[model samples]
Target: MNFSQLQCFVALAETGSFTEAAYAVDLTQSAVSHALAALESELGVTLLERNRKGVVAISNAGQKIIPHVRALLASEAAIEQEARAARGLNVGKLRLGSIESIVSPALLAGVLTSFRTAYPDIEVVLFEGAMHEVGEWIEQSIIDIGFVVLPARGVESTLITTDEMNVLVPYGHRLYDRAAVTLDELYEEGFIMEKTQCMFRLMKRFGFELNKDKPSIRYQASDSATILAMVREGLGITLVPRTMLPKKLEGVVALPLDPPQPLKIGLAVKAQQTALRGTTLFVQTALSWAHEHALLQTVSS
Candidate 1:
């Protein structure tokens, strides 16, 4: 099938809505429908099933074929990238994935700036989500490169920086003014929790396990700002990365763990063998920028 039909299939599979799929691919709804209809007719198989409310669900065949479709799209992009590269053109697209808690807000802006200046023709698209989502996107080839917390598994990674986990509590709390709080103390009466796999993995890295005696989690939040707001209201205490703190910590006391725990942040790709040339440069530029700005912590290279 033509790339137009394939693109239509992928966009519909991702957005699950014909209208949003059309918007994503810059096509009219009717055009997208026609393209998909042509594709299914040619394949002799149904790829998408639609409900009465217009939500699209992947049929069994679609589920099996979708991964190959994504890979085919990625291969097309890579081919286009190489054609431009052979012509001595500095043009390509870089898609990045990340979680909010680990990326340094200021340094990431600088990283983007340096990357843009170095490859002025390259288009950068960012997809921000939770850590697991970022990892999944990298593995699924949905993104060219992504930021991940090390020591991670199932992807190729280059260390960028090492960060420490911290705790935040409202003013006037007994532990608010402590020098540092221990993980045991914090989990003994577990507070509001940040919903990230990296946090638990970070603890696991430091010889702490939440499995034996699971901490009591009163509330869970995905956004760091919302977690801070929850703590500010004294709903419960929460732990977070220091880099995640906002410029102003008005009503919360941010404290480090007594035995400081380190979280390593890095860039990931599915594999270097399949990575685009631009993706390699983006990784190097990010490492260079981190070094130039003194953002590099424990991890080197």
Candidate 2:
């Protein structure tokens, strides 16, 4: 019935948890419960149903109301969006950061161009760094937002893309012509670990040790370019996210792993940056561009 009630209702419906909804909307669980109860009472129907299995979902009657409720919320958001868009033209600045791998294939330039078209006055400053550096910047409030691999720390995120992990081998390597590479075959080769931490990150996703055998580490570098160069020279092979591979595969071939490991990427910001005008616009623009280009798919809600 009121703004807070609407917000709480949407949060509860989406999260399906009193505790999670409370945390999401920044309210006490009791407050969330009270607000939902009041709204249901006013509407003369129970929206959320619960049972003995500790289950919760939208009630039959609630399903009918949800569409209208969502429309109301969407209209309200449009009103606010218009105001923000107008003010965005007057003055704004956003500091953006990203792990280097996501830059080119993400078509980040399209996002930037769209954002600039939408808010010509807003200035976007970009910082490229390793995964840890980006996380550190977000935590320190050094950058307003960034593209981070999900299950990330220190920031809230909305998933934007998932790039598959691939094994990069030199042109004439024995496995170069293979469709896929197995973990055993991969670990046997000398690894040129890059600073991106792709192995450990994907390891966490798969819940396993990627380099369990202490595979020979022929080289390590902070940049993917250096690692790729080493790979080209037959020094060692490395795991590279598909998004990071060069358009022309002259030096290395990117082969999918037998059981594909996915790299989930998201547009992330410090919790406080969510309310920034420039940051909000950039996020919106990036998502819109990705969706239009068929460059995005959600890994999780």
Candidate 3:
């Protein structure tokens, strides 16, 4: 059946009366009844039962068709919105997200400056959180898109850059005098680690086992600022992607590892969302920024 037929059917099912459904859709009661009759005939099932009281859901077939009708209505709305954006009349709040550590005033200002210059009328809102939290936001439709490090599961993404992980140490520390060091050198040192599942994947990549029984972990945190604070106080050292750092983070030094490892950063949206213009533009800006800075190469398909 046609989309208009499904719309009329769904409204009738929800309102439970032809008169009410007709008012809701701005159609006459006769038109609503005729559309529903046509739909029932096409599907070979009675979707509504009518009596002196009112119309009611008649069978399991009606319940099954309700979801499909909702999907069709949503798709139609998306098509209209996308068409408007394509015509250069884009106007809406763009929900955005990024890992908390990388939301520096300098970096954010630069990206916003560029985006606003292109789409000045679009309102942009940014949410900063840990990677997992950002991923959850994207999945739940709470945010349109997010920037996160990859080898991430449960979401689809377009890679923007790969950032080498660095060891953050106090400037006066003995290891600070060296050019680079191995992962084993920091094994016995008190370590500041991300207190999440990400820590395991990152450590595992370096051939290090994160056993809770070990006493190496001196502190745990969910954000990079606290990780830096701990390192600044000479409490311990932690691994972080270089892009997360701001200039003038006094007392802490970023040292490249002998066997360097990098974390992949990308723009990710819900894999099932077929219409997200703001998200698509944001990903393009992210990759363009990375390319201009020579920070990352384009991702091979």
Candidate 4:
């Protein structure tokens, strides 16, 4: 089948809806349907089930061929990349993903500057989400690379930096001036937490069985800044990565946990695909910049 037909098949298989697949491939719904129909007709097999309810399901034969199709697409992309490289053309598009907490404006700017300096013709697209979402994007091939916290599953990673977790308390709180605070001590206070998988993983790592003894969770927020604001307003105490806070604390105090919980940050990519040329160069540049600037001590996985 032609690449366009394969592309249509892949998009439809992944999205499971004609409209969404068309949007993904930047084609009209009619075009996408026509391409898929042509592919199925050529193969003499039903690849997708059609229904009046707008439901799309891959047939058993389609399921068996998905991996092969993905591999063919990847090989085609690699060939195109090599051809451009041989012609000395710095042309490529890289899709990157990162968690909001780790992607500060300064850091993001530095990365973009470095990448652009090396490959002016290349275009970079960025997507921001929570750590878990970033990982999901990588696994689904939605992004070429992602910045994720350590212990990421279903992908290979290269360590970029590491930061410690700190207990955040209100300025006038009893534990504000303490040298260090224990998890048990913090458990007694009201808690405001970000609704992130990393937070849950951190708790599990520290042997805090949330189901057995749930902390007094007063508020659940999606952003670290909002959680910090809630803590400053005397809503509750929370734990956050040290890198997430600013240098100066106004109405809050961040104390080192009695037993440090180090957060390891890394760049992750799909386990199945080797790094593309653009992706490899970008990762190297980012690592070098982080090392030269002493941004969050570099670490190894």
Q: Please provide TM-scores, in order, for all candidate models, with all chains considered together.
A: 0.89, 0.63, 0.64, 0.80
Residue-level lDDT tens digits of model 3 in 167-226: 788878779778887877776677787776455456576787766655377788886777
lDDT of 2 by residue, 108-215 (tens): 778888888878877787888877788876765556688887888768988776678788899989999999987767556778886566565565466545555656
Judged by lDDT against the true structure, how good is candidate 4? 0.79
- Model 1, 174-292: lDDT tens per residue? 89879998877766655787676556656667776776556667788777678788889988887678877887998999999978887788999988877777888888998898787
Each model's Cα RMSD: 3.3, 13.7, 10.1, 4.2
Q: Rank the candidates by TM-score, best first.
A: 1, 4, 3, 2
Candidate numbers sorted by lDDT from highest down? 1, 4, 2, 3
The prediction achieving the highest lDDT against the true structure is 1
**lDDT of each prediction vs. the true structure?**
0.84, 0.74, 0.73, 0.79
After superposition, which runs of candidate 2 have C-alpha atoms over 4 Å from their true positions? 1-90, 196-200, 207-213, 272-274, 295-301
Residues 108-127, candidate 4: write the lDDT tens digits.
Answer: 67888988998898788888
> Lowest lDDT 10-mer window, candidate 4?
292-301
Clashing pairs in 4: none
Lowest summed lDDT window (length 10), candidate 2: 292-301
Quick one: how many clashes does candidate 3 have?
0
Residue pairs in steric clash, candidate 1? Answer: none
